[model samples]
Target: MKAKIFNSEIPFYELLNNDLSGGEIFTVKSEGLKMTEIEMGDYPEYSEFVDTDAFRDILRAEREKLRYGDSKTVRISSFNINKSKGVLEVGFHPSSYSVYKAFNAIKHYPPQIFYRDAGHGLYEEGTSDWLDTGITGNLIRANHCGTGLFIDCAGPGGVRVIVGMRPNREIIDTHRLFRTYSASGSIDLDDLTPFEGVLREAREEINFEADASQIELVSFGYDSQLGYFQFSFYHRSELSFEEIVTGAKGAKDANEYTSLDPVAFSAENIDRTVRDIAEAPWEPSALWTLVVLVARLILSDGAKKGEKSGVTAARIDDFRNKLEKEIKNRNYESNFKIFN
Candidate 1:
């Protein structure tokens, strides 16, 4: 798969390979991108935060309340290959940490001890972490799978992207950053396979029912920064933007999203959207997912037709050139290797 970023068309797998090769040390420096750096000493309450003996006791009690035999585990795996040679370069599993642990680690303690407790095998045996530590191992360790949906709608104006607003504040705040229309939590121990999990999330989070026929698998890969296998899907909506908004409004109470926002995907407006996405407090995966989606859209058939129109093509090329320069100046390094 190829993605058009900023105007440059790049192979999708190459981006993933570069990202994974960078390991946990890679960072994106751009305006509007919000990255949280945890410094334990900066917070005066740091000492009291880690002392969760009381919380641990509560978690222990909570475990007793769960159904018996709830501590099941799942093995997660992903492999990268050279498309040209059809040679498998690497095959690996996600990091060893549980989903709950990774979430709490990023969100911090005290305010989100619920996740930490869940991570300690109180809720499940092995949940996958959202962030990858970039450590490689041969063992098939327990991990989770996450799904992201990219909903697209075409109208008189142009294609519009629909994303969900996460309602929960105590955990990962969804208000600031926009997420896929629906996304699944850690899939470890779940009966549903990773693809099933994606469809399930669409129904639960957006009240949008989708089946295997309606959803198309756009990309499936590992994000080394966020240590989980991510499956991205594309669903074309027959409903108009107004109808979508109406449906979402009616189902707001039943879903995790408080509301839905449809952003127009056009060369004229992409810069603003990119800035908005960067400024918002978004999930790391959501950010990268949008980047990939935008790239794909730019290379779509519709975009190709627009290129003949002159105006749209010029706008897109300008954007791509700008992005290419930015990436070039950054000197981003990767360590990906191919094995013969």
Candidate 2:
């Protein structure tokens, strides 16, 4: 529901004593003689006053601000639309200049406004590194908590990464894609098995067999919606066109969870697609997965370096013992939430 305040309205303050006791001045409609629902809240006394029409002018100007212009329009796919501040916010592609131009033309509300680039053409690439100087929500908190990404092995040339698509019966064949795919109200960092989960999802969804070593950690990101989070991981091993065709043979009638079309993706197309989808994942948790995949590829290719391996399980019992001793010596527990 929308409440409108018109021009040439007089400002009045009111005090209402009721279940909630708080009051403020309201602008009276010049011709309509109306006020906002908020203005009508529990006020016992109303005081009318005449002052400069600054607030009214500002309101009118804001209302008159146009949404789109003649400039190029770029679509930004976002994991969580709720991530943007205000009741609503407009977002654009990361590489899009028009988005910046449009947003800069209009002053934005503060403390909750930000832009995140998922990547170009509906793939995950650069969302995790996005810095949001706004209040943290559940998705953000989950990303901060501990999620990871995974990339399927493409070829020596690398795989085309796409943002995790929304949960559609057509997209992921839940039964066949993963060895064990399950859902929960919450996931424990200790008990979370994204690697196992994703492998299962890939097998069921795409009918691909992926070895554990074939998966690599990319980066960490979060989804503001669903509050579900994950890590991004990627792989570059590829199959021949024949292999792809053969693997997808019986996908249709098997489970009715997904439909496989053995399509080929070019490097340029894949890059753009991954980047575009990064802005929005069909599932917000998939955003983190996309980010991690992109990050690993970039790092392995000598593009960026010095990334942190924030989560881990000890390889050797001796190392584990030593590390635990050191941690215990310093009396250090993880500063972040680690539910398992």
Candidate 3:
């Protein structure tokens, strides 16, 4: 499909050409949103837990303790940008086995370097126009930080299942989360397709299948180094806890030096079990989802005490049908572009 895009500074129109047959040009509505505006203030405080020296020392300790006894090497890739009044920075740290091992404890995506052209070394949070600069894996370089997500299944009325991977070691501890081992490989870590990657990981790790219908794109976020990313989360059909755990245990490959580990997700113990992989180390999507899930649990619990006051089942079904038709109409319009 072909359309025109114009910037305020440029008086003339610019042609926007695309082969996609059916999609709306919603860019106009999203133009004003900046990448660095996300608030990073609410992250867990680990001030007493780690200092730069202590962190580096831990890395050294883990390397010394490797089963195969290999020395760890660090790799780094980075970039800088000029914002309105400040410089925005984004990028990645070293690409080494030790960095991979550190992912479990950090719980954040890999860290990329962020720096401004002319300012103090540390960029204050929330002062820049963009909240996060992280992008999809497609855009990541070896030393660039790309966006990714951590999605664990929660089913059977809010019971949570943790997803984890272990590479080259029996287990590693970060953020105190007890993660199970899983097969590890150097796959593209783009944010846009991390959902698909997760599904692929699920299949390889535990022989579990994720139907497209069962998956949902519930969260969206970015990192300072990566570009736009979608944190897609999914929940499979009902399965016994033993089945889930068994699936995890069986998800090891013959050639790889990793294994899959799945544990039940419980908020009370999650902080103790789930580690951060990123440098900034926060899962806003997962965190917000937990809040929503918890709220839903409360409402559902209260509903059991009394008659459900929302729409009747029949009415809800009718509304769903109506909504489907509307969506189809919109899709038809969007699909029109591919033909043109």
Candidate 4:
């Protein structure tokens, strides 16, 4: 399948490309939506297996912590985007995905992709025969997913930059540069809407608190490699680049990353800027988020404060055109197809 993609090397598969015509937004909370309950015994097939015991033994704080806080997560059974109504309906269930399941899902798929230099050039793909939907693993719920946000700062004198992070060496995707914030669907963060969950995480990650007014939904994608679903967003920050960095020390997740990585953004050379960012050792999911957002920012002409981001079919077509060329220019294009 020539899956819709930003690049073949990247596992991100663009599923629903909703460009809201009027900078509109949608929300998915624990209430007022379609949800179900799925137990572990539902699918017993073990085409791919993960040794929970061995994963626990790894000397990683993040991995070990999840075991204790076994919280419920949102399992995305299905989803739909009604452009006309500006509605995003997410069909999910209460599921639990601890480190055991996350490890099983991203072992080779993300480890090697993000840490290109460290990877041994070998890994596996897909959790089970779950290519049709999301991957549900044996020991964990790999189908349980999260959201990623690409936040940019509007610094002094219109000095705008894309914010990224160099993760701490002990985390899951150790020391790789990634998006500004990540809202994993857990007991407290399980919301499909861009504003609720992502804003919550951003506050914790960088001591920056933002509401729906400054964010926009870029796209929704499924990572075939790990059987993961990712919601992407483009967020604008009013704080200067320097102020944003200093505030991180005050945040609860201050130790989460070693430092921040910001890429200068200008519409004149955005294609080149994104290509350059792609060259860094990056978490594939974050890179995937960057791939879709740069185009939107360029067309939007710098995100405005106190305003919601909107998308239209015509705008999407333009962004897709630029993205296709960006991927093809690198000769990194392969199976995944987006914008089609």
List the candidate numbers ranked by lDDT, top first. 4, 1, 3, 2
Q: What would the TM-scores of all predictions be?
A: 0.53, 0.31, 0.36, 0.62
Model 3: CA > 4 A from native? 1-124, 132-192, 222-232, 253-285, 299-340
Off by over 4 Å in 1: 1-73, 78-142, 154-159, 171-182, 188-192, 221-226, 249-255, 301-340
Cα lDDT tens digits for candidate 1, 132-183: 3232222122233456776766544555655545544434322223344444
Worst 10 residues of 2 by lDDT: 12-21
If both were scored by TM-score, which would come out higher, candidate 3 or candidate 4?
A: 4
For residue 60, give model 2's deviation from the true position in Å.
50
Error of 3 at 330 (Å): 50
**lDDT scores for all predictions?**
0.43, 0.28, 0.32, 0.51
Best by lDDT: 4
Candidate 2 stretches with Cα past 4 Å from truth are: 1-192, 220-222, 249-281, 295-340
lDDT digits (tens) for residues 1-340 of candidate 4: 2233322345555544322333433433223223344543454432122234343344144445552455556566556555555555565555555642544434535353322221111122332233334333332334556666666886547767777776665653422234344332222335544356666677777777777666766666665445556666676777777888887777876666677766766555655565556444444455555545555554455344323344333444454456556656655334333222
Instruction: Provide the lowest-lDDT 10-residue window in model 1.
Output: 20-29
lDDT of 2 at 217: 34
